[model samples]
Target: MSIKRILPLLVVVLAGLGALSSGPLTAQERPGPLRIVIDEGVIEPLPFAVPDFIAENGAAREYAARITRIVAADLQGTGLFREIPKEAFISSVTSFDAPVQFGDWKAINAQALITGAVSVSGRRLTVKFRLYDVFSGAPLGKGLQFAGTTASWRRMGHKVADAVYSRITGEGPYFDSRVAFIAESGPKNARVKRLAIMDYDGANVQYLTDGRALVLAPRFSPAGDRLLYTSYESGFPRVYLLDLGSLRRRALDEQPGTMSFAPRFSPDGRTVLLSLSVGGNTDIYSLDLATGKRRRLTSAPSIEIAPSFSPDGRQIVFTSDRSGSSQLYIMPAGGGEPRRISRGKGRYNTPVWSPRGDLIAFTKQNKGRFHIGVMQIDGTEERLLTSSFLDEGPTWAPNGRVIMFTRETAGAGGTSALYTVDTSGRNLRRVPMQGAASDPAWSPLLK
Candidate 1:
């Protein structure tokens, strides 16, 4: 189905199955009591408890425990919620329908409490959960239930965490999303690279391409069913579109004398913006997926690449060296005069527009050090969030509250790893991975 038709259906399904808020809070609304407000700067993580879910039958005993652990891990990883250890619990929940003893939870200093039940019938698994305000002695929100195959129990856990996070923070959930990146192995001088996709928390990793071809910048389509990447499989840098389910790929808008790379999809997924290099001069071009027609969006002598569309699809943000240093520029979606957006004293590249449309994340280099930073659309209020030997390729979470990027340490044996940071420039954590990884692109939350 076309993206125009599928987008609304996915939103409806996520609202019904995941039980997320149909209408989010407006900017004028004050945050709830359980909200983790960052408006005043850094704050301590909120403490919460998730007791082991009640196992409805023998078949669900193992799943019940595993899902509860996964749910706790998801919330704790955000650095916004702290999980109280099970050993410190003073109360035991034996029945899903039992009334909660809010006093028992409050004694342990847990501001939030989570209880759930798990059931398994053949290959199908079911989980239902509720969140409570321990001190208020009331349920924070309505109970939610999710069902899927036993193999997908982890996903159901993420859905529950997403719902809880949205209700408490007044922001969209990102736990149910995926990240596509380039996995690296071997020596730094001769690294082997392949395209890989995984859960948002760096679990369930699956490689999409072999190491025979060098690939860079694997970007997901708006629907998360396809990928756009630059590959050297054809002896020259070229753009290729790959189907995630079929494992099939084909060249994209190839031209005989020009090299194409750094491709990204429009918000509607019906068009693509790419960098086309001819005779060493590079510019940005947009291609219509339906008609195979191409239009040039940039016509400067300097190089321009890494084009990303605004959330509303009305404008484009890209990296350009027109100002004698790599910097960010914004232009109308249909092609027009560009305006510089990076005014700070540093070189910037890989400018990615956040899903929230409030900020643009980019990589900055100054004084021989690399950093990840974000700025408003007009390039004001710029803030650098991270600094390291090498930090680049900033991609936004589904909620736009956090960013994931590539960080490389110094030295010959030092390797690259994926890291996440909050937009406020706090809570930097390394993503758990077995090998070097880079060029992360986050997917929209799963339906």
Candidate 2:
């Protein structure tokens, strides 16, 4: 019996949460701590306030306001926290060491209050911040300070926001990371593509590769210092590994007449998983980078692609049509019998295992519509988070709380854009960018 024909059946069930619209919540509506429960029903976003950061020195005045604004934008953009406008403040904070007027903030319904100070010396910058519970009149945690070069002001701002987010949500921070994607220009048919990297918020964009070759799926290594992408530079799709620090790259798993694509690094960064086609058949393979050895993980006749390693590196989730339709499957990382995990009435592709190891995010096409959905590891609790003309390439944030993907309209004037949504299927928003872009792969939080 063929390996593909003997796999156990794990039926997929189509289920989604009903849309619930929530009005702006008052402080009284959410009277408990600012903890977000993803499994619970939709709740109103928490309200918070951030006044201008106090300048500790004459040279730091310009940075103080900019840093404060960036931090506020980061929190508000998540749809989990609403920023109270400065016009609603009844008291002003001028000193970093001054006690917060909790009563004034409470009067304005600010549940959380952020205060900070910025200092600059030569090219050095330092920022300190404190989070306070306005209702309880107590600090959320000990004050913290971060020091770095002045040129990295935005990163410093992200770090502060990460600290506050971690303290409040009890999840790891994603703001202090980067995203690698395909930066595109020109017409949709003859578009030029280049490998690009940018901050998580889509700022500080830097092109790593010129538009000389067609590159796709720039997957960041676990260490966040290398990239694995498919390039048609050799006139066929081949996987290449690029050293992010030196801007140098080399092809991998090159054979006489084989084509390889869909490359991703294993959790330990020691091995690579990719799809290799030979004699019109494609199967997943793993390569040890250090030894130049390869192992075929699947021996099925059906085309298999988009292999993603689980967090523990013990298993993998990928897409296959062995079941007569494209669906998701899970198997041992080293290769074994596979089991279907996608049970819906549609085609599921580009299955990405969540960083939290609890969910699998994928792109589904059904009823002439494209959707991004999440399901439990065992193929249950499927929830479609988004639907559009074209939505593909789902990537997760470092914390696994949000997902970023590619969305394109269906027309001659359609252009590709990046977007994000909370794991709870809420807070869908577009990512700001300069032009057409797609194929995003988020990196681990920067050290």
Which segments of model 2 are wrong by more than 4 Å?
Answer: 1-32
Leading candidate by lDDT: 1
Q: For each candidate, what TM-score against the reference?
A: 0.93, 0.92
Clashing pairs in 2: 12-343
Off by over 4 Å in 1: 1-32
Local error of candidate 1 at residue 21 (angstroms): 14
Report how far off residue 252 is in candidate 1 (Å): 0.4
- The top-ranked prediction according to TM-score is 1
Q: Which lDDT tens digits does candidate 1 get at residues 32-112?
A: 467776555777899999999999999999899999988898899888899999899999999987888999999999988
Clash totals for all candidate models: 0, 1
Error of 1 at 5 (Å): 24
Evaluate model 1: give its lDDT.
0.87
Clashes of 1: 0
